[model samples]
Target chain A: MKREQGAARGLAQRMGIPGPMGGAHMELNGNREAVVEGCGGILEYSEESVRVRTGKLAVRFVGRGLRIKCLAADSLVVEGFFTGIEFLW
Target chain B: MLAGLARWLLGSVTFSVFPQGGRRGAGERFFSLAARSGASLWGVRRRGEAFSASVRAGQYAGLRAPARRAGVRLRVSRRNGLPFWLRACRRRKGLVAGGALAAALLLWMPSCIWSVNVAGVSGPQAQELLAQAELLGLFPGVPRGDIDPDLLQQSLMRRYPDAGWISVNTRGSVATITLSERVETPPVKESGRYYNVKAARAGQVVSIHATEGEAAVSPGDAVAEGQLLISGVWEDVYGASHLSHAAGEVLARTQRTAEAEVPLRQTIREPTGETVERRSLRVFSLQFPLTAVPAPQEGYSCTARVETLSFGGVSLPVSLYIERWEGFQEREVVLTEEEAAAQAWREIQAQTDAWEGVELLRAEERAAVQGGVYRLQVQYTGLENIAVESEIFTGGGDEMTGDSNVG
Candidate 1:
């Protein structure tokens, strides 16, 4: 499965298209709201931080009064005073 | 806001996910399983070891399998949506039935006329028109289908020959009737009848123009009341007598007199401060008094006010009538001489105004105070038409014997 993913990433780079395992696509509005697409699932949830797995990477959101405003199969919306975002592979 | 409304319409349930057997990460696993299973959730928050989130009510049941696989238990905390409200209403059947009945009544009430409004006239004429309209099945509470406006208009026009125009319009619960009275022309007398023109008032003959008769009195001739001014009998050129109707205009100078007397002391009814009020309800044609007090038969003046109920600009047949009766007491009022004179002159003026077609030439007024009464007398010389038609009774004689009749 690792070798197949690497081959797909190489093809995606040659074609100038974003690979599936690149990272979760995110949209941020000021510091108040965040929409993350390509969401695999929620890995961790708390009032101060939320970690979501997107394919091969995990996206962590750290904030005050953090909450998942909406959670669907492929996308999720997080709302709060967003302080930081990190990607861990 | 739109998402919230959509959730409300589709129904939603808030539930808490707790780990089974004290397993760690069970809440996270449950959320991930629910998301992968295509269930939408919102407002995810944590309270200690349990996590709560709202999911569509239909999708909540599907989460049971995901919860079991994730080693967690799902417990519904609250339900918010249309389905829950309907479920709660199922227990109280009376409220639903009452709401349905009220809706039906609102739809049906407007089909019947509740108010009959008459315009373009008032008083007894308006009352008579309403009575006639009621008799024609166009009254209050009558169904709109039962009243034909064209038929009602024709019936009312036939009833009042003097009405020039009539219109009936029904809108919602109000029926409006509009009408105009026709001006009637005076009837003309038959010319075949043998008639004589006589003095209606005692006055000197100023001028006479006989159109169909011989002059009985010349100018400057003094005439008395009921005296003949023009004769209907005249002689023809052939030595024969003929009787015909006389038509003429006789202008005469006439003396007119009017007198009025006012007493210095008069007994009048004065209103006492005490009053009584009574209420009654009128529904359609039936009236019921709400108050227990009996109406006063005498010495009390009553003023009535009517209030009709209306809904959404449609007047209802229900009316509340309030009558206020004030008591009157007999009191003697003393009038000053000047006041009495003023009142007497007012009466005299009213009388003079009633005498139509009289042109005043000279006038004199006499005022006297006698035996606790103020008397005002007015005398005037005026010119007016004095010829009035008087039927001639010839005693069944067809011919005359005098030379004056033969000319």
Candidate 2:
């Protein structure tokens, strides 16, 4: 299953098309809103920071008054006054 | 905002997930498992060792297995929305019952008329109309189904043949009755009767045209009051005398005189400070006095005010009536000569105005104050119709005797 998924991703990259299962995609609007698609799961949750897992790494959001506005299986929306974002493998 | 309302209507539960042994990331694992099972969650936050979030009420039950597998315990912190509200209402039976009863009354009360309003008429005529309406079974507190507006309108029209238009409209709890009375025309007299047209007042004859009788006087003829202008008795071509109803128009130049006198000292009524107030309530057609004081018998002027209760823009049959009576005392007032003269002139003008169908050609007025009395005299020369009908006696008497010349 991993090999087949890797082959599909490589094919999509060669064709110059973004694949749906490629990796986690994060969209940010100013410092107030963030939407993360293809998220694996929540790693940590708190008022100061939130960590969400992508394919091979986790995205950490450092902010004040951070909250998860919505959470589904593969997507989640975060709203807060953001200061920084970090990726950790 | 729309999503929040949708969640509230569909019902939702806010719960806290506590890890089994204070283990970190248990809340995240639980959320991941629950979300995989198609449960939506929002407001996920951490407070001490427990993480709190809300899930759809129907999906909350499915979260238990996920919580167990993720080594977490779920405790509902608060419930929101319709399902919880209905559950709470089940415990208070009286509130539900009272709400249902109030709703039933709101649905039923509008089926009956609570008030009757009569428009386009007032005073005794309005009262008479209301009485007639009551006799026709269109009163307050009567069911609307029993009232047929068209039938009631027809009945009212029959009762008042002089009414030009009548309408009955029932809307909600109010019944409005609208009426317009017709102007009556004078009855035409029978022409078969033997009658003569006589001068109503002494005047000089200006013009006369007889249609059914012989003209008694010519133009410029001086006639006395009660003198005949057109005689009903006339001789036919065969020389046989015949009596018929006289029909003619007689225009005359007449003189009118009016006199008025006003005393310098007169008695007038003046209101005293003392006043009595009476209050009453009328429900349907019955009235109950709220005040115990009886109405003043004499020497008092009264003013009344009535206020009706209304519900939801519709007037109700219940009303409050208040009567205020102010006492009066007679006082002698002395008037100046100019004031009295003005008053006497006003009276003389009022008397002259009472004369109808007269066109004034000339007017002369004289005013004098004599012995504390102001007297006004007015002479008016006018042109008017002077013909008036006088029935002749044809009761087996000699028909020639009915002529003015013979009488």
Candidate 3:
């Protein structure tokens, strides 16, 4: 019971706390990210399943199921339909 | 329409790919697709100046949490496969247009009633005429396309008898009314004969009127049956001999009084309503024929007519009519004073109306009652004199001509 309480406290402190790795990064407006396949990243990604920091967004054929808390970068993760996604100036 | 979509598709490429945001650009395009969609495809043409210029705006209502789900963006037409926006703000023209619109909004709205209107024609008191016309509950800003011009003209004409012409027109936010006045014509001068009206039965004249020809008797005149009480022939003391083929005059009354009796030798009237409905049909140029029509069944007589045929608006090769008459009862009619007065007036009308042989000029009636029996006298002028002058007054007699309204 004591060990579980210590782990939870550590997780709360680390909420949205960026690791000291990226170069001068600023918080985005809380929008979701979708990464392209075959791109260099610190996470596994595809058109359906994605890992953002430690949070995972995956859509399967059946019921609601999840594998979360896994991601890195400012890219978006998409699932259902696609053609062109955004305009970057 | 396909070409338009192609152009937009080509244009969207530029706005799609730069500084990509959450892949939401895909979502925004989907929303726009939904908004501007239908079985009807839209095509735009820019010939010389564009027909319309508008600031396009759209919204995406698909998401409940819009803050969390940013609307997707579209790829725009850009150079060398880049996001559509220009590298730098290049021109101030768009800003200038916006600023001008803002300034105009701050200034006065340039709209007002430029003028009051009258329709069909204008009268002497045009302003007053418009006021009277407005009483019909019509006003400016009423769409001309929606109104029936003839009906509106008729309504306005009724209120302004003096007007000859009236028109309505609108420009921008103002409406204008225009009008012209009617020309007046003097009545014809009548110089003709008069006939004496004897009493058909004892009764007082309820009314006496002289429209054009001379009146031989006045209202409230009481005379014995067959006595000369009303006359149409009037003479000047000089007694200069004057001639008139068919001079103007027509008169009638609503009532006269007389006593009626049984076995007093009443008029059988042939038990037939002898009404002649004459119709003419054109066979060719300047030719008219009275043709035969279908006969009626037994117990009835028909005055069948066949004129010229009509094809569309033009007269055709033939025209005809079919008439049938049924039996009518000729029962004894016991007339009171009111009936006698009415019958006397009706005779006066018969004397002063249009006729085939001699022109009707003036009519007068006299009445007397005795022993529950009424007697009546009907006298008419021009009935004898018009026969003396044939070919003096003969024409097509269409209403378009000045002599059209002759009685």
Candidate 2 lDDT, B1-407, residue by residue in tens:
89989999999999999999988788889998888888989988888778899999999999999999999999999999988998999999999999999999789878988798888997778878988999999988788999999999999999988899999999887899999878777857685567899999999999999987899899999999999889888887998888888879999999999999999999999989889999999897679999999999999999987787977755678999999999999999999988887888789879878999998889888888888788888899999999988888665755444444412
DockQ of model 2 vs. true complex: 0.52
TM-score of chain A of each: 0.76, 0.82, 0.19
Q: Candidate 1 lDDT, tens digit per residue, B1-407?
A: 89889998889999998889989888988998899899999999888889999999999999999999999999999999999988888997998788889999899878888798888897777878988999999887788999999999999998887788999998877898999877677957675557788889999999999998898999999999888888888888997768888879999999999999999999999899879999999998679999999999888999887787877655578889899999999999999999999999899889989999999899899999999999988998999999998876554457433323212
Highest lDDT against the true fold, candidate = 2
User: Which residue window of length 10 is worst by lDDT in model 1 chain B?
Assistant: B398-407
Give the alpha carbon lDDT tens digit for every residue of A1-89 in model 1: 98997788799899999755545688899889999899888888888999998878899999999999999998999998879998888
lDDT tens string, model 3, B111-200?
Answer: 332233444443456546656545653443333344444565677767667677665555443344567766677844443322233344
Q: Kindly report the interface RMSD of candidate 3, rounded to 1 decimal.
A: 18.6
Q: CA shift at B310, candidate 1, in angstroms?
A: 7.1
Off by over 4 Å in 1: A1-25, B1-5, B20-22, B110-113, B117-316, B320-407
Q: Candidate 1's C-alpha lDDT?
A: 0.87
Highest TM-score scorer: 2
Model 2's chain A TM-score stands at 0.82
lDDT of each: 0.87, 0.88, 0.37
**DockQ of each two-chain model:** 0.59, 0.52, 0.01
Ranked candidates (lDDT, high to low): 2, 1, 3
